[model samples]
Target: MIEIKEITAEETYPLRHEVMYPNHPFEYIKLPKDQEGKHFAVVNNAKNVTVVSLFFENDNAQFRKLATLESEQGKGYASKLLDFIIAYAKTKNAKKLWCNARVNKTNYYKKFGLKETHKTYTEAGIDFIILEMDLI
Candidate 1:
């Protein structure tokens, strides 16, 4: 069985670093606004965190640092977690839900109904595009 629940920003660091920034320093995975965002994780039956994501709300809701353990990929954990975030954002009445998605992963996010905008950028040598789903 797997469970999804709110976790601390610090609790998200390890998975984020391991999956998203393995070559970068530990502190590189720490978001500056972590303290102001809500964090969540997916824990497997073994009680090990396999997926992590951080969300922030303003006029629109934005999610960042979404990562899944390399060993746990292709099992639908990230999809489930993203569904939960979308539902949670809707409950808050956000106008939209967005993320800075890795360019290569844009197709994966499109499966979740997120559309890419004209916005694109390169950060840490990785190309990213702004993806958003209208909520209202």
Candidate 2:
């Protein structure tokens, strides 16, 4: 069995660092505004957090640092977590939901109706593109 629940920002750091920035210093995965965002995690039967994501709300909601353990990939954990986040955003009356998706993962995000925007940038040598889903 698996469960998804709200978690502290610190709880997300492990998976974020392990899966998203393994080669960089652990601090590389720490977001400056982590305290201001809502964090969540997907825990497996054994109570291990296999996936994590962070969200910030303003006029629109933006999710960041979505990561899943390498061993947990292809199992649909991230997809479920994303679906939850989208619904959560709507509950907050957000006009949109967006993310700075890694360029290589845009196709994966597109599966959930997130559209690629013209904005693009490089951070830590990885190319990223803005993807957004209209919520209103």
Q: Taking the tens digit of each residue's C-alpha lDDT, what string does model 2 give over 1-136?
A: 7988898888888888988899999998988888888988888975545555556566788999898888788888899999999999888888899999999999999999999999999999999999999988
Instruction: Show the lowest summed lDDT stretch of 10 residues, model 1.
Output: 47-56
Model 1 quality (TM-score): 0.94
What's every prediction's RMSD, in angstroms? 1.3, 1.2
Clashing pairs in 1: none
lDDT of 1 by residue, 1-136 (tens): 7999888888888888988999999999998888988888888975545555546557688999888888888988899899999988898888899999999999999999999999999999999999999987
Off by over 4 Å in 2: none
Record all residue pairs in model 2 with backbone atoms less than 3 Å apart, i.e. clashing: none
Error of 1 at 47 (Å): 3.2
lDDT of 2: 0.86
- The lDDT for every candidate, in the order shown, is 0.86, 0.86
